[model samples]
Target: MSHHTAAKLSRSIISRLGTRGFSVNISETTQTFARLRPAFAIRNLSTSVSPNGSPKDEKNNSISSDKSQNDKIIPSYWGVAPAKLTKEDGSAWKWNCFRPWETYTADVSIHVTKHHKPENFRDKFAYWTVQALKYPTHLFFQRRHMCHAMLLETVAAVPGMVGGMLLHCKSLRRFEHSGGWIKALLEEAENERMHLMTFIDLAKPAWYERALVFAVQGVFFNAYFLAYLASPKLAHRIVGYLEEEAVISYSEFLKDLDNGSFENVPAPAIAIDYWRLPPDSTLRDVVVVIRADETHHRDLNHYASDIQCQGHELKDAPAPIGYH
Candidate 1:
């Protein structure tokens, strides 16, 4: 109820009580009534003014008003807010991380079983490095899909951001366009981070696992940054192999869901919205889409490495913008 309407009702109640011959304490009755007020209604109330021309409560009311103003973020300019979005069925779009327009149906039929054989020293080094990294993760998580995916994504998200930042700097230095490589790399990073978000909703990791992610991300980010700076070709090749591993991991995840090892739980709301899956989609559906995503990442990174290896800059070929 509005403050003015509430005040009128409060006075009516007190008048009725007085007429009914009840010896009532006005202050106590008002206090009791105030206690019964809805929380939102009680909020931002001007302090009680005892009828003695006192300024005593004014200070408290001003303080509370100041705090309320400080806590609430009001839009400052005409362009501050974006238009609200609705889903296909006209329900409000609930996600802030992604928009409905950005969402798409996963191409589940895409052939995912492709591999790149190491033909050169750089390729061999990248392949071996990825192999070395994978063994430790396998030993640690040991078949815990959710924990493993969460950990994997923390490392997986590093490459694209690092690569994008470097290319962005190069573009700035040369005063030229990146030919969409920057956006492509950054989008890949966002997608990888979203993978982590989805996994986390399904499983809460142990404290030690969370601690490990903190340490691992700090170290891996710097290491990958240096690796990309030294050789973009090698860095992209490494990520290509890493994505191949992700595809394998996700395929196994799908199998576990099917074979009754992992529960085929309903997909997280975030996953459903981001991937534009049906409301009835299950974890199995989530895995299929995720695996398909990994396939794209694998091929995209390998394609990126190939472009550089062929002595052509990434700008020479069109980057797959919004390819996912």
Candidate 2:
């Protein structure tokens, strides 16, 4: 081939490779062309190396640097896939964490509240039940929101587990699916349990508080079970209101932290791992994320109530899995 034709063929091949996400370094291509004919290659091929570096080289380095940074930022544990297991009878079994569809953020703020009238029997019942529990919590705990949170999480975890269990049984009995509500509720229960675990590391509850947790869990579990049986709509509405109070309480906790009323201790290891928080995260960071979780629960329970009010089962719609 003539020297001119050879140069044209090489340019065409390079363009085709570039279209397929491939690139040839200009210097390398020039060297290859030099082997064909020194004078022609030197005349046709030219490359500029700037003071910093070649622009193409810098761009490639920057892309690789970005990929490495992202890999470091996102931990492997964030959304791990499950491994399959074999049952005793050789049947396949698998279980995994509920991964959220969207990234978790502590910056988003959502506050929702519901007012229950004294004349409305069901609303009144739920209102008093939540108030009866909240008044003592505030009066006793006062500024000790960490301990209060530990206690509250213990109770909060109960409703989801109970709701999930009931729904599972109902699904089996009625031969109908619950639109994944059981799995969603179970995931919520687990998430709340992790919150309790995280707080336990921060605040050691007093013996009385431990007893309080036990007594409260016992009574509340049975009461909530009966309440859910009687009316799932009322149960969900009550949880929604309870979560609103949680957001308020956490907001107060944040205020206290900012005012230096509460020491800004390093966040627990569990909190850091679960929330993918920065290495230097403090108790205030933990509270911010926990408050976000409560907000999510508040919205979800209210949505559930709305579905029930529309004369439809939770099975009629998809549950917000891994919302927290």
Mark the 10 consecutive residues where model 1 has the least summed lDDT.
60-69
Tens digits of per-residue lDDT for model 2 on 272-304? 656768879999999989888888887788788
The residue pairs found clashing in candidate 2 are: none
For each candidate, give its TM-score against the true structure: 0.76, 0.66
The best candidate by lDDT is: 1
Report the C-alpha lDDT of model 1 over 1-324, residue by residue, as the tens digit.
Answer: 999999999989889878556677799899988777645333644433324422223232211122222334232212232446678788766677787877888777877889999999999999999999899889999989889999989999899899999999999999989889999999889888888889888999999999999998999899899999899999999999999999999999988888999999999999999998889999999989988888888888999999999999997888998766
Error of 1 at 243 (Å): 0.4
Q: Candidate 1, clashing residue pairs?
A: none
- Candidate 2's TM-score: 0.66
lDDT of 1 at 322: 74
Q: Following a full C-alpha superposition, what root-mean-square deviation does model 2 have from the true structure?
A: 19.6
lDDT of 1: 0.84
